[model samples]
Target chain A: MKQVVVHPERCVGCMQCQVACAVAHSEAKQLVPAQFESPRPRPRIHVGAGPYNEGFPNRCRHCDPAPCLLACLPGAITRVAETATVMINVDTCINCASCAMACPFGVIRYHEDRSAQAGKTVAVKCDNCLARQREDGIPACVEACLSAALTFETLDAAYKRQTDAVARSVSAVAAAEALAPGWALLNAHKKARLELLTSPAPSDEKRAAGNAREDTHVRHD
Target chain B: MQYVIIGNGIAGVNAAEAIRRMDPNGRIVMIGDEAFPPYCRPMISMVLEGSVPLAKLPIRQASFYDDCKIEPILGNRVTELDVDAGRVDVNGKHVAYDKLLIASGADPRPIRAEGLELGNIVYMRTEAHVRRMLDALDGGARRALVLGGGLVGFKAAYGLMCRGLAVTMLIRSGYPLSMQVDAFAGGMILDTLTAHGLDVRVDIAAEVFEGKDTVEAARLSDGSRLDCDLVVIGKGVLPALDFVPRDRIEVDLGLVVDPFLQTSAPNVFAAGDAAESIDVARQARWVNAIWPEAAAQGKVAGINMAGRTVPYERSLSRNVIRIFDLDVMTAGVVDPQVITGAEVITRFDPATRHYRQLVFQEDRLVGMTLVNAIEQGGVLMALIQNRIPVAGRRERLLAPGFNYRALA
Candidate 1:
């Protein structure tokens, strides 16, 4: 399936991706015209400050077992089997924000649309630009990224790119090892780092452990 | 292999899907007592409110059964389970199976009040119940007396109110949703419901239903009578396990199942509201009757039945409901009675109708209740599931801007 991969290091924090996303979802589908629309177009992607000063655009990961999909009472949010894109049907949404609350990533946003529900609000989230993709195009965010920070590619291609990068790094390390006999420890560390970077990210176990602690601390008032 | 699943609800249907994925050529037979195809039960209230039509009730499309290649025997009830014989009697006909799953779900606990036998006394359980209630409402039934202040009861009352009926909710306890939320949150919910023109009476019980052929009035335990044309009994549900013999398969409030959802009987398994699985919060065996848990349990049972070794992960009790335009959610060990030795950090903004309470035992979050503001619920549940220690981060949990990544 095609997914938008984020390159935070390459991001300049321009926020053009957010603007483009909003415009893409707007009725006019243009920057200047969308701003004058009845209900202001809301961006599905959010450009937020990241750790280490590299700003990243956070959006829906479209998790297989999406919590938003499970929490939706109106059955508005659904995953299309063909595209594997999690889409929300705004017509059926009750604007309950159940999906918003259930999203662990806090990517789903509530947009007040006067056109839809007489100024009533509804849940909105990234659909991976499914409409544009049908025309063999990428998401608006990817298209708008001036720094090439976002790229839409298949999962296999993404993994291959990462593996190729790691292979090149390992080869560079091997060249260095030929010159220095004391680079064994550095090679092991590099391999470990590559493994961590390449593998599918696991759910944060440490944070979960912190939240599940069953001890008491006397509060100092 | 012949895989027979009783009750084509979420659990049975998901199990069938999972079984097909595992064993390609397995013969899957899904039996349901309901005439309609498997539908989302939670949306029944929306249907009653006229927000969602009955046509949109089915969870999957009409071609889903055919695509899955599973035989569906709808409107046929399973009468007996012959564990030793490896077969079940469905409406008197015995159907053999290599493995069996009992996901018959649950039925509304019968109200034993005096006037329950009268007409217009309804229990919200099946599509038929919604149809009956709708029919009565269409026949100009205006006043509604809804007994039980729980989730089902509240939904019934709210739905009735939406249909232009005057709804009066009678709660046996001191507050509504006492099982899910605390007294404080329940009071807020009551206020919201009342603001929407609902008559909520707490610390009250129906002494008797009084009428000639139909319920005309409900006599309260507090010496008051409520005149009503319709009565909706949302008094909770019990596991529908009458088909299985108690001696053959161990049964408590529900059928007892192992971690793999395997019952005491060989080749027989159980899932959904019908099975008493482990409560992940309490680390004890109990039935968490929520839909997600049912789906998870069903998937686990299906995989194991298909010769795949996968243990069922115990699920925490979690529920999200919209009551009178307010969103209320509770998860994990939120019941105050059982959540002893836990420190509670609460933040309530009555002005905004946003209330958040986090329950922590030592440094770990064990339970949480969010009213109006519930965006952090999924994060909280993940923390509970992962057993994350939040030692000094209790305050962050109730914060509106709290992010799970920050904890990481």
Candidate 2:
């Protein structure tokens, strides 16, 4: 599942990330004008209340299959093929706000005024500072973050983390077997028997964790 | 009230001009550290490149100051400023002021390395710098080594190249102008310099100078050495704030000024390189050391000093450069971290070695790096300056063909 992993414990609540976001959206490439001239700059990635009193920022979790991407009737949101980062197209946004409503994370916002040419409200959200990341090593928010709270990791990196977790599980099994070889064999047999007694589980994580021998037995049958 | 202005660079002259407009009858006294009049610091690169002559580099004629009824105090060093007395001592002579503006800009960072006091070693900042280098060049100096790859170093290298000297630029970073542009853009600049027969090295520092009186050669970190007759150290400048106290004023990388360009002391102001104004767009105080911003800021300082309550607000860090033929421009907060996601429009023809990149974070143009396509710089700058909300996906701005309707 593709998602953003936020550690609110790391957030200092500097709101430099917010200022960076506003600058990303602003025409002047800065946050100018009196505070009253514009709306309190809406940041797509918000530094929400700290989780577990950790005190950090939050944004779209990008659910397994993002509900916001699914709910967009105008097709303004698309995942980048290279990095799978979600990008929002301003022109295609009809201001239906269905995406905003569907976003479980509430990451999307519609502009108050439509761009002159598009004549339709534009949708704003984080694009991962794609250009800057491609040019520089880090994204603007991550670069500007004095606390070093935010980061961007590749999909391969996430896959590695899960796979490493699985390796640890396998190593744990090996350690249990070393302590009592005969007992370990008996436990494997007991696990195989339990699989036969219970109905096939649906959760993929559990299924991946299940004995491979059971699948072999089913295939033979 | 007599307004006494010290220093005569872009910042000082700009303040003088602004004060003349704000208080026509107010006796304005302008003191300059340099003998020459106000000129653009940004043009120093062009000056070294020989594109602009020394005479033409000045923004206004010396007569312009006299025409405005501003007394020009040239070649005088301001020894002290008595904050309590509201007076400045120039060459031990006291000049009283109802208000004092300190625009004494920074000097080139001194070279602490041994043999730096030699005849051929130079630091490019004023006309004397160019004249000194030219004097050596006239004396048949053949090889030149520039110590930094920033704007100053690059310009110095370019100028030396114009004089038919073999030029080499040494940088401690991986690429040139790494502080301003990205690696890709920096590489493009390197290509331009190399194409012009200039040797550029990154990740290398000037380890040692080999000569005694007039420097002869330089040894690099890689154990390689280059023969050099002239050395121009373009190391960055540190703000000259010796006259001001730390407690009375805030000092970050530059002096901390409020939106009004006022220091902590009342009736005391600062402008140009010395004052660190807030980059209004970023909502952060940063040193805007560029030329146009310095001029605009000096004007604002003057306006405020003349009893106009105009709080100077808008500050966008903008700079455009044409290295060889590559047009590079970046404005506002051009940090890599801000670009969360972006769409790029690129047109690269390998045969010509030309490249153009317009980086958009979502639909807005947050940062851009361009090479060869010099003309598009203005349009992208306009988008950044206008804060133009992009209409479509970022790809629209970066189409295969040029369509400037996005600018409109």
Candidate 3:
């Protein structure tokens, strides 16, 4: 199944995805009119300013054996196997922050949502855009992402593409045949500027090991 | 392989499900005192508050045991345990098992007060107890007196007020939720409750109760008499490990368990409120009896019992309470004043009505208490639980708009 895969390196700190998400979930599926809707349709996807002042889009992973699902107080959270989506029953939710305490990624938010009964507040998070998928439309965030930071693809296909990029980046004709060369160069410059400003070496060291965008820059020194 | 699990709580239920997933052909026997379908224990307070209906409590159906193909024994607690023989005696029945799980959760800690054997006085712990309280409430319980300022007491007080009952709460501590939140946060919660019609008495205990059949009044420690018809005890809980032979098994406040959730006895394991695991934040053996911990511990324990070696690590004490207009979340050591070299950073935005208190041991976040704007509490708590060092300007964590990008 095609799911929204985030490529953070490709993000240019543009919050267009946030605007698109709010509109998609709004009673009126348009930007200008969604602003006027009661309760003001909020975006499920949150884009934060990254460590290097880049864009880091944060959304629910829809983790199997989801921590939020298990930590739910009223048993309001459940896993829908078809979309691999973890959903919250707004009616059953007691508005207790039990799910908030258990969510390690801090993706869940609480507020008065349109789906909640009688303007009641509920715990809200990414639902994999199941409503859009049902209508044969891709997720609004992916559609609005002009930079291709967000894409709709299967996990296997994403892994295959990333794996190929890693192989090609280290090859004999590496620089000319790099994957997303513009994005790779942009993040590299951000990292360099950040290193000169900060004194600590440990966070950078940990980031170097965990970051996948560093495939092009293998600095042994 | 034969598996026997004690208690029908989340811990035991999850363990049974875990064991069945690994060893599908294993003979599983589940013994529980509550005959009702496996329900969410934490939502009992919601039921008391009248926010959640009684039907919404059960997490599973009546056919859960049959669906799992397990033997079910209900309405009975284990009378005794023969650890050496690997048998549990309940209602004169000897249930033998190769693998044993003591997931019997905690019970409400009893208090000593006169006229204890009266009607209308109850403890808010089990669904049955909550049902009894509901019966009193349905019986037109107008004036209610509550003891203790802990989670149980606070919830009961909140529930009664919602039901239009005049509630007078007595707390042994300076403020409510003393165990869960710090002085500042506790005061905020107390003020909210007070505004919502909760008559609170601090540093006081019920010395004596005077009533005919049902409790009518209580003499407090401060030499004052309080008149009330309904009474609820919100004192905290202690582990329900009565059947275990402490001489053979190493027992602290709760049953001592290894990283694998296995007890000292052969083929015996424990989880949930009954087991004490190492606290990731405090770096000590502590029983985090919350529902989330119990659920996590059960899965780990079941996997280990099913022959897979899964270590149960990173047990942290955490709680999030939603009071009227306030969302308070706390984790690990919120009170770090006594700890040497503890650096505390706090911020309160009067404009946004958000408050954040971050306690640090060096660069690593040891504890935190978030008042409002607590959406990112889990991210902050993960740093504490994993002992991850904070890299950026630490003050950024106290910001109302803090997110994962700040750490990047």
Candidate 4:
């Protein structure tokens, strides 16, 4: 099944994902207007600054083995048949706070008294803007990320990349301190901004580099 | 049988059309309290910027009613409803109906403070509200004290900003839209508003509206006074259910309705800002006062009223607005400390003032907030709704200009 995989090493944590998700659900059907109209503009995803989390934009992993799906009492959360992504059915959500309570990552939130459904509160969490994809073929958050930090992937490939990302993060901390002293010591917010300017560029393979060189015109003096 | 619908707003207009589509043989009569034709309620703010003329706000043409063979009685309101006898009193005349719809949408909450009813003071709901606001603008109302920082409050503030009026939003809450978005996003929004040169103060309630014959100023709860030529009260709308029996049908933000948009009483239907429809996401029955929800609910209510037995699907309590050229959108619940285990990820570009965040549990996306960079709003929205798995490509999902087909 496809799922969201984050490369925190590549993350500048620009927060485009959250705005994109909110806009995806916005009434104005666009971002700028949605931001203005949203009172408590429920953002499904959250971008936080912490020593433990660093610059990664957090979202549901959509596990092959799901915990939240099993915990939901009213069966509000479900796995889409096509994408194997876990989704919430607003119709089925009872807002019992069961699945929300059981969530290990604290993804599900109870939209208590502000909704139209009685005894049924909206659970605020990321469905990955699936509605947009079904119609437009691209998720809002995924398309909006500028640092190439957030991405979509299957389980096996994600695990490998995540493992590699952790490794890179560990080394990058050292490299970052060396390249720019006192940078690694900076807090999450400062680090995120610095990462925006200093993060390593996407590695180019040999074939791509060869293609780029061929495209470059030579100036003979 | 004659069917009477109250209100010429989105809900009432759509209800008329829905009734025509269902019960073509039945006589459809629409009663509106406003003089203007049915218009998009959300577009009212656009009028402040002169982006749309007062005449263009109507959702449909004048011939719409004529084509549908519907009789629309404008500039009249039904103050009394005789549900037992199935009749409504409008302009001293009783209109009979076999099935009556109480689509009398809520009016903007009026400021009870003294001197608030002056020519300058206005509630931004109808065309008249806009007309008064424009007149005041022409009268050189240099400053505006907007009461309440809710959707309407913010919209008015933005509109006033567009009009080059020094605007200050006074809210009783700790922050603007504290109930809808998280503190971080809210802070970002506050910053955006502040950056636009509007003064926004939260946790300071309006104790009283102080002015002479006309609105001149407002006194705050924090012992501060705001001097302005205009004052707007946008404390939200209360359902216009004065005619209905209080004990028979319960009302809490609005008229309580079942999943099918049916009222507590059998054969009686309710929709629009007046009815409490189910919030499919939050799974609670609360009154959603937005335009799209009202229109969609009205259509569903009409279909079901015609013996179609169609179920009303609650939409995600969604709102989107524009501040200058910046795009901002929010969805789902955003209460603080509500999320315990969910991993929060934020991407902020202070230089560009762009922010995007996604909240996830395990691997699935459940909520999001977007600001500035909103073109990909559809993509992330789909992922949240579809809960698309981001396992391998979670990193790619955050990449700028990622291939669309790859995600699919």
* Residue B102 miss distance in model 4 (angstroms): 2.8
Docking category of candidate 1? incorrect
Instruction: Residues B1-408, candidate 2: write the lDDT tens digits.
Output: 899887787777767777888788999988888877666565555556665566556656668678879877889788877777888888778999887787887778876565677789989987788878878888889999999987678778877887789998888777677767766667777777788899888787777788877889888778897799999999878777776767766678777788888877767888877778877435468787766566667877888888887786656565556554565655554445544564445545565455545556554665665554333344455465445676633433432222232222
Candidate 3, residue B151: how far the Cα is off, in Å? 0.9
Poorest 10 consecutive residues by lDDT, candidate 3 chain A: A212-221
Displacement of the residue B369 alpha carbon in candidate 1, Å: 1.3
**Interface DockQ of each model:** 0.18, 0.01, 0.31, 0.02
Predicted chain B of candidate 3, TM-score versus the true chain B: 0.98
Weakest 10 consecutive residues of candidate 4 chain B by summed lDDT: B399-408
Residue B149 of candidate 4: its Cα lDDT? 86
Question: How many backbone collisions does model 3 have?
Answer: 1
- Model 1 per-residue lDDT tens digits across residues B115-166: 6888888999888899999988887899999989988998898899889899
lDDT of 4 by residue, B218-336 (tens): 88878888898987778887877777777766677788888788787656678888988766434467687766567667777777777788887544454555566555666554452
Ranking by DockQ: 3, 1, 4, 2
Those runs of model 1 whose alpha carbons end farther than 4 Å from true positions after fitting are A7-14, A48-56, A65-83, A92-102, A112-122, A145-149, A160-221
Residue pair clashes in candidate 3 = A51-B408
Per-candidate interface C-alpha RMSD? 6.9, 23.7, 10.8, 17.2
Residue B142, model 1: lDDT of 92
Tell me the fnat of candidate 4. 0.00
Number of the candidate with higher TM-score, 1 or 3: 3
Which candidate ranks first by TM-score, i.e. highest?
A: 3
lDDT of 2 at B210: 81
lDDT of 3 by residue, B124-188 (tens): 88999999999998887899999989989998999899899999999988899988888778888
